[model samples]
Target chain A: MKIALDTIRHSLEGAIPGVVATCDANGIPNVSYVSQVHYVDSNQVALSFQFFNKTRGNMLANPQLTAYLIDPETAARYRLALLYLRTETDGPLFQNMKAKLAGIASHTGMAGVFELRGADVCRVLDIERVPGAEAPRALPPYNWLTVLRALGQRVAGCGDMAGLFEEVLGGLEEMLDIRHSLLLMWDECGHKLYTVASRGYVHSGIGSEIPLGCGVIGVAAQYQTPIRITHMAAEYSYSKAVRENAGLDPQRLETAIPFPGLAEPHSQMALPLLASGKLLGVLYVESAQDMRFGFEDEDGLSVLAQQIALNLVQLQQAGDVETDTAAVAVGASPAGARLQIRFYPANHSVFIGDDYLIKGVAGAILWRLLHYYVHENRTEFSNRELRLDKHLNLPDIDDNLEARLILLQRRLAEKSSALAIVKTGRGRFRLQVNQPVQLLEHEVGAAL
Target chain B: MIGSSAGIPTPMSTTAPSPPVLRPEDADFIRSGVSVCVASRDVRHVPSLARGLGCAVCDGGRTLRLLLVKSQSEALLRDLEKSGQIAVVFTRPSTHRSLQIKGSDARLETASSGDEQLVQTSFEAFADDLLTIGFSRAFTGLYYQHEKSDLVAVTFTPDDVFLQTPGPNAGARLEPLP
Candidate 1:
């Protein structure tokens, strides 16, 4: 009886090495061990091209082939009749396979030796189960349909980008049973990803950045593909190793806050958030146990990321609106403890009484907001004014204005500073300063 | 030294300039807790695989012997019977150092007295290797368990040897043993 290849995907993850058999033109057969058989789709699977061997030669001469795979959880064996298609040396599939192979190689003690030259694509003609008397019953890793349904509803209910970020991270933990995860937004100009929200870590790691093509997260964003590594590979760990390997300038690397990752992560999955052919960010997750995240986990997270990307685009589009200048009159200056606010014009780094608060677009937003409050006597602001503010230099009109505001608000709350921003309504927010404020602006390259 | 006095023909030599032969240096590497997988295909091209319990080299390194658990190798054993062709891969779990040997003449025989000890030693070494890499002892123990009665011996003469390591010169053959 023929079965669909998708139903037995656990066998393709390289937990139990696959075996491939091909016959030469002279009817001589050859069999070889396959490190991994990547599941491209229901009808297609790609084998890693690490070495030029008889199997490859036979496949080039005779496309008829057979492969055997075994499920790690259950001892069920499957036989696949395949037809050789083409080889992909680059692209999303190749990147995904390459990243995964790194982890496998490292785990098997073949880190530098195993390099992916290409992905040999094959058409799975038919799949048959190798009948065995022992039927092992193992619990399914996760119910993808159930988790996706519940997560879709949760994401849809989020009224704003902030709520969407919170719900997505929370949903991953509560609904999908994923304990550790992070959400990073893409910095297209800088070729980096900045951490905005994360769960299951001692530190939130907000504002930490990783360069594109540097680590697993960066590679996923660079190729706009999902990279899942079942074993922890030191070569792909983010932060210090990635920064050092990339040979990034120390000053530039210093600007990037260290990523909060497990000291020894055995399983990791990074999925790119792509919408309309543009990468928005990456959703990353890791575990201390080996094989904790399987193919099902990657598929589920990929679907969830698609939903998030769509919602993010929709929320950003909805944030573009006209500002209300009627409430320009600021409240009377508060009589209390003095709070010092300093802003650096060069990099937009903001500090509150010697403690660094934030920088970049969020810092610029805060600087402008405070300038209006102290000088222009404006306590209320809208997303439109911020987007239209030429001085702020937002990357685009469709910039994530609302998301930036939310991030700024959260950072302030976390710092417990005397200043706060409250959402008054859709597209509008109000600043509430509890103490007398001393605002200072510094020239470029000036020390605080 | 390309052909040498060893009977092994080094089939991969024609494909590439270098001839890769089974050498003494690779003997311990292959036998030291490396992952061993044997593969064969039925007449209709349906492949079958079974994890080898252990492996041994004899006949001046020209012949290879693989020990497999009979109960777990129903399909693979049948495939071996249908066609005398077989391929076996020996890969060090830690280094991914690998070697693939193809044989045209294959036959099954009863397990010899020393073969049980070979299986036991390989199992222990493989478990230790996996433990170093963070695999649970329980998982490894259960993964390689086999009953003494369930063992079978598969012996084949090496017709071809290929460097299965991942690199630019991976498939290149080496000179035969002098």
Candidate 2:
């Protein structure tokens, strides 16, 4: 049945972050968030989706479908029916979608600034009134990483609290588009900031020590409040010791921010890591772009950090799983305690020492990150490439990848002595392990 | 050269050992020479041709013709036939170097019907390594009038094709693809 234009408009207005789904000939489905939907005619509407999505693939394969728009808060639903028609440059439908999109892009302040490409045209046939489907099941409130930690609790238990901390650190990096993310745990006895887990800048001798409230990272430790700085002048006002610390070079940190070659602008955010109302550590994310973090980012990161705190507390309560498992497996001798390594031609993982071996797509992603530890390479690769490498070609990784890494990092900490490795960052495929071990080992029997 | 001597008229002093004359555009596609004699074109569905041989019908001498593909897809041929799209299929078998295939009504998927065997066989025979397939809009300057026009040229390289016959005729030259 034909739905009226006014009704469609009302339905769309309530559906913030509308979702569009498309399928390829191979039956692969893709879904992404779209901004606003514009009605071209009574029988047609157009919407702009996040660039480089699977919906385009589906539209090319089978053009008939409907879009689901939902209310994020109340979880209400709206459906817009559409018929994606394959058209050339001169097709009337193609021109219509483009014209409608131009207005929306301009209203969003994008206009011609961002590289906005148009996909094949599809006529929006009708708006349907479908009852709201369940909001993509509210991701279990228990942080996935925390859940994995609990599952592994009985099997391996949380061994490396330090490693668990780093896994959580990585999750924070991903949620927020911050380069050079670091988690500095507060030492109650020493009253100092120590780099427990870090990504981005290299750790020289000086970064290892900072008195509480002496620097930007340290002040967050002291105050237990989240802080953000748009410029270094603001950072200097926070802590005089931070202004002089060898690690606090605003110019160099600017160069090291993710997305190399864009070093003109700068932004920074620092958040406290507290579990049970006790300061566990501080997370710092820096960007070379101004106004980089928006309300969505702030909210997402706050939730992510809170989840990390829960995981850290659970790890502490479980006691060190890695040490207990390792003492039985390896003798007190240093050689016996040395972390054992194994490599697989394709994908490989094993339960060694305290950490579980995560190979294949998990292995590739983890390996790429740890490799970054040796020499900080923050080249942003596409999600497709990262997923293909990790063999997890599902649309999203920011959630699943972190869950897996959290398990891996905690397990590795249990198995090995080095507690400072395995940090995560904003980019896809990142791993930071304290031990600089070569992933590929030479077999003595095969070589001369 | 299984059935070449019977159906096709051979030129004087032509032998299977002699190299076949190739159209200029198709020469690069036949560096190693023809390997099999599948059908040039097929009008009716005929299965089990000589147990392993392939067959198709071509209107003899069709040079390249420009067409447009409305939808870019894995089933490219099917998408081409979906209307408002353009492409060229062969009409009959002929031995002319400069062939013309202007406005010829042709059928696609005559042999395989639904299977992609002909496309597979054609790719294997034409280029052993299966380099590239000819699609619409290759010779755009000559064919397309407006930038928005959906037109592409389909160039067929017949050098890798053998006429099913007793022997090859040296004077049998292929028409140039676009």
Candidate 3:
């Protein structure tokens, strides 16, 4: 069977450097090693225009070129006859190529030298297998379609936002074989993304934030497009982004929260979870091995992201269930250490003693949960009750209530405080306080 | 024949000034475990390329001889026969230091007695270089494999040498050799 150009798109990531050949008008041919042959579409690809060399000169004169690409998986080779189209210095394509080039440059020890001047788009005129080359070996045993089908079913069965979050992360690990992954929520006003859930890390990194356009995850959220990097670049590394942003405003940066990521990741893929043109957040995954996540993984995650966005919107719109008005008798406060909960109204930052817990929606959710537990003596809570609570000012139907609950639970656990929230049943939880709690509200401008 | 050829622009008219000879240091860099590729174009200006097995620089760094697998050189050889012009690139994978040498007069010949050993040594060195960078030996060996009977040599006199390294001076012509 003849393979289409798009079928082998993953092989174009430049793991095995591609050879691009172009001829001058006089017929003298120039061949140069290309770091990447970016797949633009079925019939088009883009090459990085880093230098004004013989290959570039030949393309300008002849407009005809050929590129030899190798399939890293199967070691099969293909020849593409390409016609130079145009050069783009800016926009999504340029940014995508620029980010990818940074990774390649760093991987090859040419960090400062390999800058992308432009993205030279070309029309793939034809694609043919190199005659007499070995046939492509069998692909890996995993079938994406089967995995996607099972994941869709699991996602559909999720009863609430928390369940959905768990299912999504679980499916990525079990169904897709991805171990290290994170789910972050977009903070529109803050201009950052905060981690709500994570897997395969020592710390869950809940509430850790990455500023928009900071790294691979940030770039994906900024453009609302999927960004994949085969080789990790220091320019886009999370640690570097943290250090660079730390000098800025403390309020604007989440410096107190450490971002959880691999110390040295060779491959990373970030996809924006967008619904109806609104950027919800980003789904990120990384691996220590190079080229671990290919186009197939990207496509699979893309489909999952779309479904996740839709479900989130639907659940948010469903709103909270009607509140139960009957007041319940509160049990006497347990005898233990006194826990003081201080709430800063300015940024909605909540602190238990001297340690900062969370801010924003998650913070608001904690404040609300504790408020009910103290005043109403409400030991039990459900998803619907919180959704209907007006004081929380939960964002539209897109509000990730379950994710916030998980964040609250993890944060409380990490602090090992006397106050804890444990799951008793679906969409319901029990607030366990082993000590007497004093709640205090303070103005933002007031001294600590 | 240099500038009077129809349809082909004079190579020296570009911003880059042609070098007089290949520098000794540059020749040594090329002969090292550098990645090599050769290219030529057909009458319609469509280009063809092939991996170069190894290369030898002689005659005081004036003559360059490139070895290629014959089975993979069909299109490249055809282009050479038509135009007698070729451009070859030698890039050190580790450092990304690269050079492009173009020749107006190129000829293809059978591999000589010592050419096989030279190609073998070059391949072994290249494989070792790749190993240090995390590529498995078996993989590198398969990539560099070529039947001795299927090897052919293309010799050319370097006429234009351009710095192809990734940097601000990339594509700039080197100083003219005395």
Per-model TM values vs. the true structure:
0.82, 0.27, 0.87
Model 3 regions lying over 4 Å from their true place = A1-3, A25-28, A132-141, A246-249, A319-338, A369-398, A420-434, B1-3, B6-20, B58-62, B110-118, B141-150
Write model 3 residue lDDT over B75-172, tens digit each, in one string.
88877766778889998776678898888768898998689988888878887787777666666666567777888999877777789877788878
Model 2 docking category: incorrect
Q: Please state the Cα-based DockQ of model 1 relative to the true two-chain complex.
A: 0.22
The DockQ assigned to candidate 3 is: 0.48
Candidate 3 residue lDDT tens string, A179-266 = 9999998877677888988899998898898998888898899888888887878888998876776544566566677899898888
Find the candidate with the highest TM-score and give its number.
Answer: 3
Cα error, residue B67 of model 3, in Å, equals 3.1
**What is candidate 2's TM-score for chain A?**
0.34
Report the error of model 3 at residue A206, Å: 1.4
i-RMS, each model, one decimal: 6.2, 24.4, 3.1
| Model 2 agreement with the true structure over B131-166: per-residue lDDT tens digits | 221211222111112222222223331222222111
